[model samples]
Target: MSIYGYESLTGRTAVVTGAASGMGEATARRLAAHGVRVALLARRAERLDALAGKIAADGGQALAVTADVTDAASVRAAAERVRDAYGPADLVVNSAGVMLPNPVDAGRTDEWARMIDTNLGGALHVIDAFRADLLAAAAEGRPADLVNVSSIGAHVVFPNYAVYGATKAALTQLSASLRTEFGPRGVRVSNVEPGLTDTELGSHIDNAELSQALDGMFQAFGQALTADDIADLIAYTTSRPRHVNLRQLVVLPTVQA
Candidate 1:
C-alpha cells in the first residue's frame, strides 16, 4: 500500500494516543514522515520519550506526553502540554486500546472492566480533550481529522472476546455519530477496523486456551497485517482533501475469511 501526495499534512499538528507501540507508534512515524507535528500520548513515559527522540532524530517534531487515556485528567493535562508545544492539534487519532479476551462464565469481571475503560472510555476522554481543537481547526479551513481505531471483532463474534468486541462496536457507532455531528462543521471522522494484525495486542489475553488458539491461527495465516499497514491507511484517510471523508474502513488480510 504505497500512498503519495500528502502535501496537505505538512505543518499540521496531530495528537496520537497509545503512541508508544504497535499501531499508534507506526502511525506516529508515518505521520511524522509526512511533516506532521506529532504528540505522543501514552502511560509509558520511557517508551514515549524514546519514540519522540527517534522522531526528532529523523528531522520530525514530536512531544512525549505521559498520559493514561483511561484517566480524563491525564488526557486533559496532556492536551494542554501539546497545545503549549505545537498549538491546537488539527488531527487526533484515538489508537489507545486493550484487548483482553475472557469468557462470560469465567467471572473475569476485572478484565471486562479494564477492557471497557481502556477501549471505550479511553476514546471518549481523548475526544473530549481535543474536541475544541478539532472544531477550531476545521473552522479555520484547515484539515481536521478524528480517527478511531476499532477492530474486526466489532462485527465478527469471537467466543471469549465478547466484552472486547462490545467496546469496539460501541466505538465504531460513536465514530459514525460523531461524523454526522462534526462533518458539517468540517472535521472528518473515520472509523478504522483492522483484521488480524501482528502486535502486542494479543499478549494481553489471559485466557490460556484462547491465547493458544489465536497464536495458532496467526501462525497458519503466515503474513498477518503489520502495524505499518494500518498506519498507511490512516495516513491516507487523513491526507485526503478536506471535503472528502473516508468515514469507515474495514481492512483485512486476504487469508482471513
Candidate 2:
C-alpha cells in the first residue's frame, strides 16, 4: 500500500528545508504519505503551518517550524526544535535555494552573495547541525540519507547564471566529498540536480530583460518540469536498498537537451 515501494521508512523522521513550496513541499508530502514524520522548515511560518495542517488532515504526521536557512543561528534554533520534537532526523533534505539572474557587468554583487549564502551556506549549516543525528541513526543500523537539491545549471552555464551555477557546482562537489567521508560510516549523501523546473526561483531576477528571457526559456519546453517530478525522484532515491547509493542524479525535461 506504499506508493514509494518502500515501507521501511514508516517510523523514520525527516527534516525538509524549503518545505513551504516547490520541490521541498512535494517531497514532504511524498514522505508523509509513506508515513515518515516530517519536519517542515522555511521562513514562512504561515505557509509551513498550512502545510503541516494539510498533512495532518491527510492523516500524516508533520511539524512546521520557521527558520531562515541563511542564518546559522536560525538554522541552529530550528535544528534544536526538530531535535527536541523528533529526536534526530533519519533523513535531511536541503532544498532551500534562490536563483537570481544578473550579468557580471551589471555589478549586482548583492544577488551573487545571496545565491552563495543560501545555496551553499544553507546546505552546510543544515548538514552540520543534523550530522550527529545521522551518525546516531547509522549507529543504530538505520539507513540514513542526506539529499542536497542542486541544479543542472551547475554544469550547463547560460549567459548570466555564472554565480548561481558556481554555487550549485560547489554543492555537487560538497555532496560528493561528504559521500566519501560518510558513506563508509553507513550514511548516504546525494546531490540532485534538475534543469529548468517551474518554480518561484526565476521570479527573483531583478533584470527585466533577463526575466523575460527566462520566461521565454521556461516556455520553450512547452512546460517546464514540475516540483512533483523532482519529488518523485527524491522519494525513489531515498527508498533505494540500503546498500545502494544514488550518489548523484541529474534530471531534466526531455526537451532540455
Return the top candidate by lDDT. Answer: 1
CA lDDT for candidate 1: 0.94
Per-residue C-alpha lDDT of model 1 across residues 1-257, encoded as one tens digit per residue: 12357888889999999999999999999999999999999999999999999999999999999999999999999999999998999999999999988788989889988989999999999999999999999999989999999999999998888899999999999999998899999999999999999989988887789899999989999889999999999999999988889999999989998
Residue-wise lDDT of candidate 2 within 1-257, one digit each (tens)? 35448677688899999999999999999999888999999999999999999999999999999999999999999999998998889899999999988888988889989999999999999998899999889888888999999999888978988999999999999999999888999999989999989988877888899999988987778878999999889888988777788999999888989
In angstroms, what RMSD does candidate 2 have relative to the true structure?
1.5
RMSD (Å) of each candidate, 1 decimal: 1.8, 1.5
Candidate 1 regions with alpha-carbon error over 4 angstroms: 1-4
Clashing residue pairs for model 2: none
